[model samples]
Target: MERPELPLAQLHAFVVLAEELHFGRAATHLGIAQPPLSQQIRRLETKVGHALFSREPGRVTLTSAGRELLPAARQALTGLADGLAAAREAGSGRAGRLRIGFAASLALTVLPGLLRTFRERFPAVRLDIQEMTTTPQLAALRERTIDIGLLREPPAHDTDLAFETVLTEPFVAVLPTTHPLAAQRVVRVEQLADSPFVLLPRAVGPPLYDRITSLCTGAGFTPRVTQHAVEWQTVCALVETGLGVSLAPASIRRIRLKGVAFRRIAPDTARTRVAAAWREKDPSPLIPHLLAALDHDPSDGPRG
Candidate 1:
């Protein structure tokens, strides 16, 4: 035989009647008339296959079945209430998992502070972080593999994706300690015209790679790139071994390599940008909350 549904309304009525042990009082507590409350108790008892209350001449009292049903009914109502509250929290972006993709280099700079602030604001939200390079991060955002991306040098035009610049830092010179230019407090781009360059390949980060090259070109010489490394640390390691010099975002200075020196570029006008990216019309509410957190963070640079 098919099971009868234990409707919440009926169970609620049962618990209230069990507590009051009086039809009129329980109906008053439930904000209903006495007859409807009596009918609810009768329906619940029918489903339970037992009489729940004994209506005597002067007093109403619980049968053994009603006593047993009270606690379990109360528990079911409490569990439903908790579940509904959690669902509301998740809908408001205060709870749930947020998948994030970021460039590897950003971990050394803005990533830590951004994540800390997000966690403090929404402690119940779980962060799923993926470290990837710029191109891959963009692809991940497009594929829905990541909900958002923190990457350097977002593309100039993408109809399906939207980007907001979150950080900008001027480029600095990376050189071997023994290089003559390293002795100077600041280096000029034109000064490195004769030196070999160790840089991240254009394919790895085209916009950043092109920006570095343009700086050299503006100084009247194209960089003679003798070595290519996919990561800034590796590029710095090559420079330390005297393979060549490089120009990188100021944050690259955070990598402490004894043999390499990072010096400010004179006139410091040119800069590389880092941006937060997402699908143009992403439906996840978490994205806005995260963007708000990024905006309020002290470490976030001026938006572009």
Candidate 2:
């Protein structure tokens, strides 16, 4: 059954009159004349289908029905006020969940600070971070499964998505501590051309994978691939076991696994770039707070 829409004005008048037990004073409290207040009480009784007041020789009091409804009527007004407040919060983007997608490389360095600042600035906003590769991050953004993505540069096929570069750092040579080249303070790209390489699969992020391979080609030889891995950490793990030397973003240096040594390339050949991306048309108010929290004049920091 449909609930009746209670008369809000009548409820206000009835409650005041019940407290004062005098029509004139109740009307004064309500900022109205006594006749109008009295009429509202009569109207309220009609809606409730019960006589809500009793009069006896200059004495006024609530009948049994009015006493029963007094508490419930106040509760209804309180609920209405609360519901309106909740709706306002939702509309203002001051409260809501933001699903953020990020590259695994960020976990060791940038991700922690980004998260910490975001929490401090917007304590009420919720965050759900997903570790995804650049390719998958782009897909998730398009599919709307994730609200925003922080990863490598996306494919240049769409103009509707906005990509903002946040960090750009040089790639470093990752080698097992036992490697002969580990003796050198700086390893040239050409120096590692002969060593079998541990490579991240192209599927993980073709642009980054291709860039790594091209660094070897630029040094006058194609890299000899001895192992294929998915995550950059996995590539580093294989290099740690002496499978081969791998090249990775400088940020990977922050991931300290035993038996791994990071070496710089002469003049810093290929740079790893990090960017935050979202649809150009996305109008989430949460975006401003996020961008503000992460805001900084990015120095040429050596990280992924």
Candidate 3:
């Protein structure tokens, strides 16, 4: 059989009266008239089906029933208080989970510093980080699988999503260490016109791929296609084999392949931009806090 529900007011009065052992004093502590205090204790005792206090002219004390209920009542009140505090913290964006998606290449640049800043400011919030390419990151944000995204070359027109540019870096040339252009301090856009080009497929990242090809076109030639790789690391590795030359964000220099060299592109006008993206109409308090963290300057320290 299920037990009956006892009102919190009765339980509170019972505990105070038990502690004080005097109706006058308990009523004073609870800031009520003595009659109401007595009535509350009576209601509680009736609910428990027992007389809770033994009343004598000069003395009052707990019956066995009241003694048994005191500890449980105190525990219930404490639990409720704790639960309320946790709810408040979650509502304030100081606690709960924040899922983020980021491009693989960003790990070499702004990802770490942005995370460190957010973690420091909201230490109790749990971070769920996923490494994905630009396209996958966008899809995850739309599907609500991720709360924030750090990606490169955000789409120009996406009404469902909003983006903020966090970093913009110039393109650099990646070539075989033995290549003649590698010996020079910088490579011009036209320098690699006739060279076999190792580039990412447009399907993988349209904007970034178009930027590279546009740079070549602006220099009066279309790059001779030779190889395609989905990842920058793979692209650089292919270049290392002397299969072709490639252009990548300056941050790609962090990849340490002994057979490859990274050189600045002269005129340096072509730059890849990384942005933080999120759904425009979704209301998540954690998203705003993360956006604030992104406002801090990204770390420019030496790459690993």
lDDT of 3 by residue, 1-304 (tens): 7898888888888888888998999999999999999898888888889999999998999889878999998878677788899889888888888899988788888888888999999999999999888888888998999988988899999999988878788899999999999999989989988889999888878888888899999999998878999889999999999999998999999999999999999888777888889888964678888877777745732221
lDDT (Cα, tens digit) per residue for candidate 1, span 1-304: 9978899999889888888888989999999999999899888888989998999987999889888888999999899999999889889999988999988788887788889999999999999999888888888888899999999999999998988888888999999999999999999999999999999988878998999999999999999999999988899999999999999998889899999999999769998999999998755779899988888888776666
TM-score of each predicted structure versus truth? 0.84, 0.81, 0.82
For model 3, what is the C-alpha lDDT against the true structure?
0.87
Top of the candidates by lDDT: 1
Distance from true position, residue 219, model 1, in Å?
3.5
- Which should have the higher lDDT, number 1 or number 2? 1
lDDT of 1: 0.90
Model 2's alpha-carbon lDDT is 0.83
- Candidate 2 lDDT over 112-230, as tens digits, reads 88888888777878899999998889888888888888887566567767876667878899999999999888999989988999987788798888888888888899998989987
